[model samples]
Target chain A: AQRVTQPEKLLSVFKGAPVELKCNYSYSGSPELFWYVQYSRQRLQLLLRHISRESIKGFTADLNKGETSFHLKKPFAQEEDSAMYYCALRDPYSGAGSYQLTFGKGTKLSVIP
Target chain B: DTAVSQTPKYLVTQMGNDKSIKCEQNLGHDTMYWYKQDSKKFLKIMFSYNNKELIINETVPNRFSPKSPDKAHLNLHINSLELGDSAVYFCASSQETENTEAFFGQGTRLTVV
Candidate 1:
């Protein structure tokens, strides 16, 4: 079974400070990792994916297979960047039996002004 | 237009009553999912459907049933709603293949009284 673990329940960082949200996963096969964000009153949306290897809204995540982690990073956190972030892993070999994701308990990030 | 949409964005209902949340995606994706976000913002997958067929059914209670009429629509029907059922339900869609990101809806907040 593939499981995602987000150790932090709440993270606080001052504006302009660097931010890192930790995410670790357990999977036996190749896994696809994703970062999803939900801003206040907004819909939860995809922030980025490990396969894309692109930065969105100044946030980037690197999939460290050895560490089994995909930590989201932002060089300088902004007040508007405060939101709930969730790490999700999809099983590549679930086949017709399963295509669901194992999501981590999200981290609530607060960028203090 | 929204890529994914869920109806009754805010549902306030009494316990023991039955209710349904509707979800539709305009992105032409083949896979859809229903996720429950609890009070602490922890997300858990309840169901997944591909082309109107069940793919993943988590260890959720049998009272919670998901029905997909087609590839574009997936609805959730809850029987005998409990206080534990109160949460934000999000609908998402994505390509069946790997390397694709799932797009989520704004979410339906179901409040059981």
Candidate 2:
């Protein structure tokens, strides 16, 4: 079974500090990885996807197949960036063409000013 | 306008009570899904429907039933809810394509006393 593992339960960092949230996945076939963010009292939204190869709000994640990791990174974290981050993986080979995502335990990011 | 929406943002009911959560998406996506977030913030896929067809049904309890009257709405009904079923339920939608990302609604926090 495909699984996503996010090792950190909570991470605290000072404003303007670089931030990296670790994510690792276990899947046999090629995997599509994504990062979703949930702000305080807000709905979850897509932050970025590996297939897009784009950065949203200064966050970028590179897919490392050898390491089975897709770590979200930011050059300088802001207080506004404080939110819960979840890593998800979609198995393309899962039959019926259903969009089922296996999500990791979210990491609560606390940015201290 | 809200792209995806779920009714009754907070629901508190006694155990063994029957409850239902309604979801609607204006994004006109072809796929809708139900996900559960446990107390520890672990998100897991519960069920998925594409064009009102059940495509992915995870190892959820039989008490949990998903109904999609159309492509734009997917509602979840729980019968004989237990304390263990208390969690945040999220409704999401996505296009039936490999590269499309899922858009999520504000979750329904269901508390079974």
Candidate 2 lDDT, tens digit per residue, A11-39? 99999999999999999989888999999
Backbone clash total for model 2 is 0
Candidate 1, backbone clash total: 0
Across A1-113, the per-residue lDDT of candidate 1 in tens digits comes to 67899999999999999999999999987799999999999988889999999999999999999999999999999999999999999888877525677789999999999
Give DockQ for candidates 1 onward, in order. Answer: 0.67, 0.72
Candidate 1 Cα errors over 4 Å, as ranges: none
Q: Each prediction's Cα lDDT score? A: 0.90, 0.91
Write model 2 residue lDDT over B1-113, tens digit each, in one string.
99999999999999999999999999988888999999988898999888646865647988999888777889999999999999999999888778578999999999999
Candidate 2 regions exceeding 4 Å error are none
Q: Show pairs that collide, candidate 1.
A: none
Tell me the tens digit of each residue's lDDT in model 1 across B1-113: 98999999999999999999999999998888899989988899888888646855547999998888877899999999999999999998888887677888999999999
What is the DockQ of the complex in model 2?
Answer: 0.72
